[model samples]
Structure formats: structure tokens, C-alpha cells
Target: MVGVLERLERLRAAADLVAGRIPDALAGKVDDVLARSNRRLAVGPQTVVALAGATGSGKSSLFNALTGTRLAEQGPRRPTTATTLAASFTATNADLLDFLGVPRRHEVAPPEPDMTDLVLLDLPDHDSTATAHREEVDRLVRVVDQFVWVLDPQKYADAALHQRYLRPLAEHREVITVVLNQADRLTAVELSQCLAHIRRLLDDDGLTGVPLLATSAVTGEGVADLRRHLSRLAAGKRAASARLAADVTVLAAELDRHVGPARGSGADRRVVDDLTRRLAGAAGVPVVVDAVRDSVRHRGTLATGWPVVSWLAKLRPDPLQRLGLGRRPELESPGLRHSSLPARSAAAHSQLSSALRAVTAELGEDLPGPWRDAVAAGVREAEPTLGDRLDRAIVETELPAERSPAWWTLVRVIQWLLIAVVVVGLGWLTLNAVLGYFGLGVLPMFPLGPEDGLRVPVPTLLVAGGVVAGLLVSGLSRLVISAAAGAAARRARKRLEYAVAEVAEERVLAPARAEVARHDAARAALDRLR
Candidate 1:
């Protein structure tokens, strides 16, 4: 009983996961089964065994023989029973009878303890010409805890019976029985042949191992054996549990066809990586990385270049700041500041879409239709906000701008010293020229070297060497700045990619993985039912 309840709970959970996703027909059928099982379970522990058959099959006669009373109307008419009639040894199963919708009920005198637990039902002919009669049979067939298919010798192999009931209910063989009614009419040899033939037909209908009995409601032949079978089932008091369990198992199997097998593991890592890469591109990470490098070089050159010309570098705008990115903003801002980066080109957008589709396909390849659709829907739903999310990531990221290399400061100091030397040399030269021009006393000037035999004044050499050295230092500073900027760009790229990956996980991968998880859970529940 514990196993039975557990299986039913699993089936219910599995059904909930795919409630509106599967075919409407299957979903409706399962819901009906669940509803009926719940009502039956709540009713009581009485084992409601139904006697079902076609017209003139003596189903009602056998019902009377089993109960040892003529509760159900039995006659030679083509269709004697149009409504379901239930007979129990005790009158306490009114709720159970009400649930079964059998208004015509009768109570027999107290019987043996085994018989007291049984609620026997006599049902209408399954192949009746009247629709209501057939409907009643179908309804009672689903709700009953056990079935005794009564067959006369003439229609023992009825195609309608096998096609309509036995084959469709092959999963409930444990709770089903076949009784060859009116066996007294057949000689021993004929009975043996007929039983053998019926067994073969039942086997063909996948009803192997279902109990077969030869009963005569008129002569009471094989009636005691039928009673003993019902008595044992009633004594065990597991017929209701077994019947409901089988119903759940069959419904779960039907649902399994729509859910497919459990996924071996979580979403594929490669698919997630590919999705993140695509999202990064769409979010403009590459563009931001390039801007970071360019911004770094622009700032570095201004810091380290010769003071006389360093102001020229400042004239150009910082690439990152121009984009409204590269720096963190106030925490209270509603939305992150938009970047000046250009919108993605049509080709880039197309590539991003293709990548998203690839991820969807990879994740949903082996999933059932409903689950695959769920995954695709999740990806598409997340796509609309991807651009904004990427922008937010960029706004929140910290660029390498606040700190400068010590080398820039050292070079700036050296360049300033060289400018000072040039300034001093020019001042000395100007003084001498002015004094000589005014006919005042000429200042003594030192000649450090001679170029082509012409004496070169020390002051003139200082001015010329300082100007030339400053140019060389400026050129070297450009190279250093380029290298530093390249490193900064690589670091920025890593940070941006990490941010993009987080967004991908939150918006895209998370939803897709959730669908997969539901699929896995549903499949696991189906396994328990099996």
C-alpha cells in the first residue's frame, strides 16, 4: 500500500510538470484517471469487483450466482441490464456505491467474513446497442477494483470485447478475470477445446496470466471456485490499492511517451560557453575592450611625453569616457548610463541569433516536443533584454584608469629637467647676444667640442642636445604607452567576458536548464510508476 501511494504521488507530480504542454487528449484522460482514483481512495476499503460482458453472456446471471441472491435482473432478452446494479453483504458502502453512481443497490444478509468486504457490481453489456448502457459499462469498468469478463460459449471470442476492453486494459491483467459462463451446456471435450481456444485468444490480446474459470450460473458449476478467488482478494484487502496502482502505472506510461527519457546530466557546458560568447559580442564587450586600450594609451602619452608638447595629447578626448562607460557611476542610478557605442550591425545581430538557436537546438535535441518548445521559448524570451543587460555590465565594470605606471611619473620628471636645461641654455645664449649687440662687455662662453673644425659653444650645445634628447624621450614614451595599453585591454576583455557570462547564466542558461530539470524530474517520476 505504501508503494502504491508513493507511485500515485509521483504520477501526480509528473503530470503537474507538463500539465498544459502535452496533447490535450492525453492530458484529459490522465486527469480523469487521477480524479476517479482520488474519489475511489477516499470512499473506503471495500473491493468493488465488477461483472462485465456482452449481451446474452449471462453476466447478470453470474452476478446473482456469486452473491447467492437474485439482486440483478437476469433474463433471455438480448440486453437485460441497462443500468449498473451493486450488491454487498453489508449496507455500509453507500458512499462507495454513490461514487460508482450505481443507484440500484441491494444488501444481502451478513455473509462469511471474506464476502463482507466485497462489493459486486453487475454492469450493462459493453456491446449494447443503447448508448447509455455502453456508457454505464465504460464508466463502471474504470472505477471498479476488479473485473470478471463473463463470456458464453457462442460469443466467447467476441471481437468487440477484446478490442474494446481486454486489449486496452492489458496492464490490469492482475485485477482481471475471465469466466466461461453456462459451461454446463458444453460436454467435457467441448469445454476443454473452448477453454483452450479462449486462452489462446486472451494470450493474443496480451491478457496472459489472467485467471480463467468455467462457471454455470444454472448448475452452480465452478461457482465455488469463483467465490474462492473473490474471497481471497477481499481478505487481502489490497484490490483497491492494486487497481489504483495499475491505473496510475498505465497513465504514467502513456505520459512517458510524451516526456521521453531522462537527460543524462545537466545542460551541456559547451553550449553554455557558446551562448556566453555570443552574448558578449552582442553586448559590445569587444568594442569596450578596444576603447579601454585606446583610452589607456591616450592618457599614458599625456602623462609621460615632453612637457612642451604634452598638452597636445590632452586635446583628444578619452575614448572610454566619451562612450559614457569605463567608469563606475552612482549606486542609486535607475538604469545604467548608455554607452556611445554604435548599435550592433544587422550581420552581427543575425550571427547572435544563429548562436542562440544553436544553443537551443543543442540543449533540446533529445527532449520531447513540449520540453523542447519550452527551451526554445526560454531563449527567445530572454533575448529581448540582452542588450540592456550588457550595457549594465559595462557600466558596472571598473576600468584601469585611476592608476598610472611609476615609469610615466619618472619620465615626466626627466622631461621637465631637460626642458629646464634648454631654458637655461637659451637664456645664457640670449644674454651674450644682447651684450655683444649693445657693445657691453661680452660674457666668457665655453666651447665643449668642435664640429668640422668650427668651435661649438657649450651653451649652444646644451640647447641643441636638450632639444634632440627631448624628442628621443617622447618617441620612446609612445612605445611604452602602447605596450601598457595592450595589457590593460586584455585585462578589460577578461572582466567584460566574465560579466557577460553571468548575464548569460541568469537570463539564458538558467531558464533552459530549468526546462531540462523539469524533464529529468518528470522522467524520474515515470520510472517510479513503472
Candidate 2:
């Protein structure tokens, strides 16, 4: 058998797990059970059995007769027991009585050795016209371990008794006993008939297994049997545990209704991937990748292009720099930084919202309505920060830089040598022309075969060959840079996507998964209560 402390611990653990997720009303009920259980545990080894019944049921009279004291006043008034009155055979149950709020206490002689641990309470009428009287009954009923429902023959089958009290506590059948009090008013046959009808009514109320007995405070009929039953319960020392276990069982069933069937193992990787992709789009990851590629190509062209037009490349803005993306390693700051990436279009925003909804729906598919709502709320709570987090991620990421190719250096040197050749040739031709103009001797010049046997000018050939060679080198370098930049762009895109996926995991998926995990844990705990 599970001990009271173990059972109470389980109830407390389960309640803590679902503290904020469950409905307030249900949470309040669970809290009440915990509070009552704590008080019972503090009382220690005392059996709190309450005398509960409808108005004019002779419950107070039976209470007085059971304890052999007139602790509770029995009278002609409809609601005679206005407050709770307690009679304990044990003297050290003051804390328990205080916790129950029963101000009136009566000391009673121990009737039997087995009944020494009993603490009896005379509670107000269950169907009292005065709200305070009914409230007292409601409050004491929850705190008591066993209920000796002292019903009169007239009001034994009252709907208020069965429907309001007995039916709801059907799980506590083991701890409940129904008494046909005032039995002296009936003859032998009438009393039998009334007992039979009461049994049938209890059966309908789902209290069929609960014990039933006939007692009379006036005639003292069946009172000893009631006492013997209470003695057995008091001696067993199981009433507290039984009552708590029953309370846990009922609460577990109620909580179980809010949980759905278990989902098998493994995380939903596909949903996470899809959400990452959509968020990457919304976060302008592709734009950053494209910027990296363009910046790489531009830098390459400036390094290896024809020196004549390289100045024009320098005049244009660097693609990565325009987006605040590719700064020198030493210049970057260690703080959250935003990219100059443009705002997402209306369609992109819509796509992102749809993706979020889709993920929430898939994750919450089998969850109860409240849990599903919680999941959605969690996603919504994380959404506003997503864009900023992604931006920070993009800034933090080490993107591919516009690294210059090794051949650019060699090509640049060759181009400068060619330009030197052109300049030397031009100077030679100019000197020769100056000399010819003054009728001085002309300098020797390299000859080249030309059409119609006319020698081509050496100076002209040198300048033309140099310019063409430089142009050819620039064109070849452009092709190689373009290809390398395309590969770098692909790599950059993967890196940015990976960073965005991390943000999605932390900001969105983590909370949702935590909720699912809580649900699973709560379900498992409730199963243990069964």
C-alpha cells in the first residue's frame, strides 16, 4: 500500500508541474486537496469522521449519543448545528481541530482501545436554508477523512444529499458510511423498506459499495455497530492514507481528461527545418549571401582588372559594406548589431506567419484545447524578438570575405611591365620624330612585315600589343572571380541559414517543446496516481 506521505508528494509534484498551464478552477481544487492533506498529515494518526446530513436529520443527536456527551445542541430548529463541533477521544489533536476551524471541543472518555484515535465532528446540515450553515458543511466535508452521513428516513434519498455530496465523492466509497438515523420512528417492516430504498438510491449515485447502517440516538439502536465500525477504522490507521489516495485518484482522473493520448518518441525535425527556412527568408539571409558574392567579385575585379579601368571599380560602393556586413575583423564590435538588409515584403511576412501557425498546429495536434492555446501563446510570445535575434545572428556570423586570388598579384605586375614597355616605345618614337624634324639621324627601330610589303611601325605595334595583352588578362581574371564568387555565395547562404535555425530553436521551438515535455510529465505523474 502506498503511504500517505508518498501519495501526498506525488499529488504535490503533479500539481507543480502543471501549475500555470491548467485552468484556475482546477488548480484551485488541487490546491485545496493539498492544503487539506497537509493539515491531516500534521494532525498525525487521528481519524476525522464527520456527521453530515440534511436538515432535521438528528445528526447532532447521533453525534451526542456517539461520544456520550451533549457537545452538540439538538433542538426543534431546522438548522440546529450552526457550526462544527468536535469530540476527540485523543487529547493531543488540538492542532487538527484548529485546522478544521471547529471552535467547540468536547473531551470524551475513550470508549474502546481501538477507538482511541477517533476525532468526531458534528457538522451543519448539508441542505440548510442558511448559506453559512451549508458553507460550514461544505468546508468540513473536504477536511474530514471519513463521513458518517446521518440521514433521517424522511430525507435519506434527498437529491441534495445524493447528487451534491454522495455522487461527487463516489471514489471515497471506502471512507464513507450512510446511516439511517432516527430509525426509531419506523416500524420493523417500514424501516426495512426505507433501508432498501436508500441502498438503491446510493447505488444510482455511484456509492453502491459504501457501507450502510441504521442508528437511533433516542433508542440507541445500531449505535454500537456504528461505534464498532469507527473503532475498526481508527485502529487500522489507514483512513488518512485512504482518504488522501482517493482524493488523488479523483484529481488525477480530472486532470487526465485535459491531456491527450501520448505521442511516440522523436522530435519533429521536419517542422523545425521548414520553420527555419521560412524565417531565413524573412530575415533576409539570402540578401546577405548575395551581397557577399557581389562584394567578392567586385574586389577581385579591382585587383586583377586592366589598371586603366580599375579606378572605376573603386568608385562604386562595396556591396557588403553597404549592408554593414563585411567589416575588417579587428573593427567589428562585440555587441548586438543590425544588418542593413531591407524590410520583408508583405508576402514574405505573410509566409512567415503561416509557417509559424503551421508549426504550432503540428506541435499542438493531439493536445487539449488549453494546451494548444498555450503552445500558440508561447510561439506568439517569441515571435516579436525573432527578427532582432536573426539580425544579431547575421551580424555575428563570419561570412566569406572578398579574398584576392594569388594570380592577381602576378597579373598586376605583368600589366605594369606592359605599360612600361608602351611608355618606352612611345618615348622612342617621339625622340625619333623629333630628330627627323631637325634632320638628325633616325634611331634604329624593330621592323615588322606588313601588307603590300610596307614595314609596320615598331612603336605602334608595342603600344597596341601591350594594351591588348592587359585587356586579355583583365577578361580572364573576371571569369575566374565570377566562378569563385558563386561558390562563396553558396557557402555563405548555408552559414546564414544555420544561424537562423539556431535562433528559431532557441526563441520558438524550445518553449513549445518544453510545453510538450511538461504535458508528458504531467500525464506520467497522473498515471502513477492511478
Candidate 3:
């Protein structure tokens, strides 16, 4: 036989199976019965007996005589009992028998010492030829660990008893006891004949192994055999507990049908996959790509030969409007403003945040642990304000209004200076030559020979050209500074996008998986109870 814990598990499994199929009324009753049985079983090995029969069968009288007390009513003028009754006295606390809902029997008796668990319930007689009394007996009989199926000499062969209770319980032959109670009323020859006839009826009822004893409450004839049997049962040295165990095993097999097979996988992977897909979309990588592209173009133009026109870079609808990515730079001059990469990137991050919030909220009903708290916090943190930072950076840098490649700027300055130099050089040489040819060379470096006669020196003019070239070189240097700043801003936007995705993953998405694991563990524990 299985051990107690294993037995309990089987019982629970059995209960779980028919738990649904059983009608509500029957189910509650079974639960009550099983719950009480578990408490009683906690007392260890014991036998329980419910002495049930027709009115005036001397069942209660015989029970009192066997237990050596008036444990149940005996002076019965049979009106067919109107109420159910029970009494328990044993070394073991057999009070658990009361959980069966049979009323306490009216009795004058002393409590017995705890020697062994034995309960003898004196139930309202069934076969009372009364419907209500019959129902009561049946109810008590269903839950007893074993039954002492008391019968009188007159009813021992009654067709109703044979066909109804005794016949069905015949299969449980070892657990049943049938007595021809009040048998002292018959003579020896008649007693033997009555006993033989009862055995034949029992055989007809399919219960050949059942033990039969003849007893009288008045004469105490053959009572010791019944007590000895009850004692052995109470000691759990009875074959009946093992027999009932077999029945319990059958019940366990029935219950097993309800418990599903065990396995390790405990999650719906599809849910997480769906979340990942949605979050990636919300990150808006495409928008960031567009912004970076524009920045790259502006940088390339500045590097090649775009002139001060570079400052004319325009971003529409305001960079600040890109989700949480804030305003365009505060470059006061339309001439110096460039890249909207940062704003576009920020928009992508916004999408990712909303997606995370949505998925988390979707799972909120079941969300467990830090994941629930983290997702809510992350969305709040995502709201950004870049307004004043860009404004301050732009204002502090005295960027020029016009923009162009340093090369273009330098080329422009050089061409102008060269023209001036060539013009003056040619003019001076021409004038000096003309004048000299007219014999004015004696006046020397008065190169213009006084067209307006300020007598400017050719060397001095050459020095001015050199100064202009130096200024052009300075202009180109500033262009490089502006182009580099734009490139850096472009890179910053990309970095920010990546940063947002990382934060959302760590704070929001990752925690959700943990929540699934935690709650699944909880579910697993509950499943074990069944």
C-alpha cells in the first residue's frame, strides 16, 4: 500500500477529477467527508463502525451492550427514528466521525480511554420501511471506514435489505459485518437454520466473505467476537483499512485524469516576441537616419566648396518638435544654423518609450516585481527639454552670419587680393613706365606719378596684399570650426538614440521577463496543491 502522504496526494488527485463532475450538493458533501477523513487519518491507524439497520432491529441496543454502556438509545418502541444519531468512544479521538453530519445520539455514557481509534456510530435505522430514516442511514454508511451492517432475525433475509444496501456493498465484503441481532429469541436448531439461510441470501447478494455473528443485547450471546473484531480493526491490524485503501487507489486513478502531464516550459514566448517587435518600431530608427543624412550633407558641402551660403541651412517645422528632441540651435544668424539630426533622433527615442509603456501597461494586470515599477518610471524620465542648452551654446559662440567652405572663402579672398595686387602692380608699373618714358622716373617710388598725386609706394601696396591673404586664411579656419561642430552634433544625435534604446531595454523590457518568471513560479506552486 502507498504511504499516507502519497495516499493524500492520490486522494486530492481523485477529488480534483470528479471534483467537477460531481453535482454541487454531492461535491460539497464529498469534500466535507474527505476533509474530515484527513483529520481522522491524522490520528493514525483506526477503524470506524456505523451500526445501521431498520427500526427495532436492536442495533442501538446491541451497540450499547458491546461497548458496555448505554452509548445509544435502547428502550425503543419503534416509531421509525425521525433523526440521525452517532456516538464515538475509543483510545483514538474518533470524534472526526461526527463530521459526517449524523446527529449525536441521545445517550448516558462515560468517555472511553484512548487505547485505539474506534467509533461506533448508532445511525437512524434504515429499512425502517420509512424513506427519511432510510436516507439518513445511507448517508452515514457512505463515509464510515467500515460498517457493522446490523440486521434482526426477521430482516436478515428481507428482500429489501438484500437488494438495497447489502447487495451493493457486497464487493466490500471484508469491511462489512452482518449480525442476526436478537438471535437469542430463537432456539439452537432454529438459530442454525436462520444463520444458514442468511448466508445463502448473502451469497445471492454476492457477498460470500462477509463475517456473520449472532448476538443478543439482552443475553450478551456472541458479543465478544464482535468486540474483538472491532478491536483488531481499531488497531489497524484489520484487513478493512487495506481494503479501503484499494478503493482509495481506484479513486486516485480517477483523479489522475484531471492532472495534466508535467513539463518545464512555463511561458508564452509569443508575447515577448510581439513586445520586442513593437518596441523596435517605436524607436523610429528611420527618422534618425534621415536627420544624420542631412547633417552629413551639410558637412560635406562645407568641406568641399560651399561658401558663406552654408549658414543658410534650414530645418523645417522646428527641430524641437521631433518628439522629445528639443529646439533648433539658437544661432541668431540664419547664416550659421545647421543640422536637425538631434531632434530627429529624439523622435525615434520617443516612439520607443511609448511602445515600452504600452506593452508594459498591456501586461500590467499580470506584471510582477520590479518590471512593473521600472516601465512606469522610464516613460516619465523620457520627457526631455533641450531648449536652453542649445540656446546658450549658440549664443556663446560668435558664429558668423554667412557660411561657406574654408577653401571657397580662401579662394574668394585670394582672388580679390590678387586682382587688387595685379591692378596696382600693373597700374604702378604702367604709370611709372609712362612717366619715366616722359622722364619722371627721377621722382622714383611715387608709383602712380600722381594721378591724384598721393604718391603711394609699390612696396607698401605689396604689404597690404599680404595682410589681406592672412585675413582670408583666418576666415577659412573659422569655417573649419563650424563644420566640425555640425559633424559632432550629428554624432551626438546617434549616440542619444542608442542610449535611449539601452535604457528602455534594461529598465522596461528586461524586467517584464522576470515578472513572467516570478508569477509563473507562483502558479506552479498552486498547481502542486492539486
Candidate 4:
């Protein structure tokens, strides 16, 4: 039980939402309907019915007969009734007449008791040669509450009238009545055939069940019945609201074409994931992951490598530092600084474009052409900023920290101790060789291999064992560092993938989804109006 006002509001909301996104002509038509409906409703409850017809159709005659006055002039010229004229059966119709812009107004003399609160307007011919006359007819036709189309036997089926007015206004069947005005010219058989033919034509125009009357203004044929119908319409005081409702209904139907049934939820997870993968590639996720891995390896080598060669590792650049990554500058400051990652290649851009199209197509699968194009256009409009957003995402992403493990410190101490033993063994052997060469006694030899077996020097054992243990410890530390590097790379990939997903959501998918939501909202409102 929605009221006419509620339906009108729904139509207004839908039109506003879909205005620019739809075609210009349709948007303009919706605006016109809203304007005319609001104005007609604002003017009181007086029923303003117009006698509308083509040139020489006896519309003025029908008007005079219906109002019981000669307020309109009838003529045999090619085109008559150059301006709109109105006859008010009640005294309180000035507001409606002013709203209709019909200045030449007349009060019915000896008004019929039955035609109370009726304002019968005899509008200029819709087919007038003068542009002003036709414009006036067009303007009044849109705002009038009801229409009594005064047609003659000859031009009743005229294409100019049916195509231009009747077919288009089929939605207003409840507020429209067709009159065969000049029916005296036809015999009874011809009139019946003419009425049947006109009925068929009305039915073709989707105006079936509309009141059709054969009235001769000159012979007063069926004029009383037309008057009674007008009296009933005027007494009900619902014509204005009904006309507005019909207008809203027609407009809502037209706007509904731009939308369709909602498909799946606006987001397609598969398409989104694919887009994220493409975007991650474009954002240099792999490069950053590799950098993380290399950075970890470089730091570990510097911390645990033999001291003699560890300084050489420092000469090579830190991979994370070279990329200006490894730190979240965005968090420390206001804006993100760009990373030194390589620019996206042309192939990457092409892949990104295809991914964006896929996203739009998936979301807009159920939309009409105009709305689908609208969704695409909205997404494309954000493309220029997408690169910057992605760069920001990469810069803001946190990589694995380059903290040294505790085992590296122990490894370093063990290597130094081994080197010290080697140094002491070399010094002792140098002292013994010098003493033997100078004819002084050598220091006492402490080591013999098994008591009765071949003996080995203590200095020789000390140097060889120290060197082998140091090599083994260094080799084991490297294997641990390699495993840690792989772990760091995996962690970096996870972080970068999350950041790229955010960029995809904010830059591409969000806008496309919003367009889909807009289409759904407009469709829902139009359905409620229906």
C-alpha cells in the first residue's frame, strides 16, 4: 500500500542516482517527468482535462459542448485553435489554470451541476503548422491530469497522432479517453465500423479497455455520456495523483533498462586473486623477496664468516639497503618514498590492463551495456593513479628484520679461538726451528701418536686439528644461514602479497564494485516503484 507520493519519491531517487551514468535523452526525460509531476501535484485537487487533437478535428467543438459554453471558436480553416483556452466549471481553478500557463480563461455560464470542479482546456492542435502552437500543445499534454482526445472519423487513425502521442502515452490509459468528434458525417453502420476500428487501434497502442466514445459536438450525440464520465472523474478528486503516478511508472520503466537482475555478490574472489597476482608482479614482489633473502645471507656471512675474510663481505652492497627498502619510511613520516625497484615493463602494464578489464567484466556481467561501460570507465579513470598507489604499497610493506642470530656470536668466538690456537702452534714451531738451527735445545715435544707407534709433533697436530675444526664450523654456519635466508624470503613474499592485495582492493576492485552497487541500488528502487 505505497502512496503516490512514496512512489514518486522512489522514482526521483532512482533517476538521480542513474542520471549521468545513463544516456542524456533518457535522463532529460526523467527530469521532465519529475518537474511536471511535482508542479501538477502542488496545484490543488481540481481535475484539469484537456481536449487534445490534430488540426480540423473539432476539438473546440467538443470543448464547447462539454463545458456548456462557447468559450472556444470553431472554424473550417486548415489549422484552428492557435492558442490554449480553458473553461472552468468551478470558481476555484485559478491556481491550476496559472500552473497550466493558459491565460485565456472563461468561467462557464450557467454551469452544469454535474461538471463541478472540472477545468476543460481546449489546447492548440498538436499538428499545427505554427511551431509555437505545437509547443503549447506538447507542454499542456505533459502536465494535464487527463485527456479527451477529440478525433474525427477521417483522421482518427492518423499516424501523426498515434505514433506521436497515443503509443507513447499508453501508460496513461487510466487518465485518457478517446473521442470520435464529428461522428454525424458517418452513417450508423460506418460509425460502428469506425468505433471498432478505433478500438483495435487503441488496443494496438496498448490502451486497451480505455474509454472510447463516438461523439458529434454538432448533433449532441453521446455528449451527455462524455459529460457524465467527466463529472465522475472530477468528483473523485484523484485524477492529479493518478496522472502523476502514471508518469512516475513510465519513467521508472525507462530507467530500469540501464540496470538488470543482480548476479553473484559483486566480488569475484577468483578474479580478485588473479588480479592480485598480476599486480604483485608489477609491484616487484619477487625482486623484494630476493632482496630479503640476499640481505639475510649477507648479514649472516658478515657476522659468522672467518674474521680474515668477513671484511670482504662488507665490501659488497647490502641488498635491502641498495633498494632503499628494509625500513618503513612511510610509518615514520607523512608520505611514502618510492623504492629503487625497477619500473614495471610494458608487458606488465598490458597484463595489469587485462586484469582490470577482467574485474570490471566479472562485476558487470548482469548490467546493461551503458552501465557496464560506466563501470569500465570508472575503473579506467583510476588507472593513472594506480602505479603511485602500488609504489606506495611496496614502500610501506615491512620486510624481515636483519637481526643476527645468537649462534652467530658463538660461532665467531669459536673461530677466533681456533685461529688463536693456530697462531700459538705456528709460534711454537718457529721457536723450536730457530733453537735447533742456533744449536740451542728445542722446547720439550709433548705429543707422540700412540706410545709405541710412530710419533707426531705436538705443533703439527695443533695446527692441523685447529684448521680442520674451524673449516667444519664455518661450513655448518653457512648451511644454517642458507636455511634462514630461505625462511626470510618466504616471510617477505607473504608481506608483499598482502600489501599488493590492498593496492588491488583500493585502486581497482573497489571502484568497480561500487559501480555494481550503484546499479543494484537503482534497480531496487525502480522495482519498489513498480
Candidate 2: stretches off by over 4 Å:
76-79, 184-190, 263-270, 328-331, 334-336, 435-465
User: Of models 2 and 4, which has the larger TM-score?
Assistant: 2
Q: Candidate 2 has which clashing residue pairs, if any?
A: none
TM-score of 2: 0.90
Estimate the TM-score of every prediction: 0.91, 0.90, 0.43, 0.89
* RMSD vs true structure, all candidates: 2.9, 3.1, 13.0, 3.2
For candidate 2, lDDT tens digit of each residue in 339-360? Answer: 7889889998898898899879
Q: Give the TM-score of candidate 3.
A: 0.43
**Stronger candidate by lDDT (1 vs 2):** 1
Ranking by TM-score: 1, 2, 4, 3
Model 2 per-residue lDDT at 174: 84
Q: In model 4, what is the error at residue 358, expressed in angstroms? A: 3.3
**C-alpha local distance difference test of each model:** 0.85, 0.85, 0.56, 0.85
Clashes of 4: 0
Best by lDDT: 1
lDDT of 3 by residue, 248-322 (tens): 543333333332232222223454444444443443433543443444444434433223343354433322233
Candidate 4 pairs with clashing backbones: none
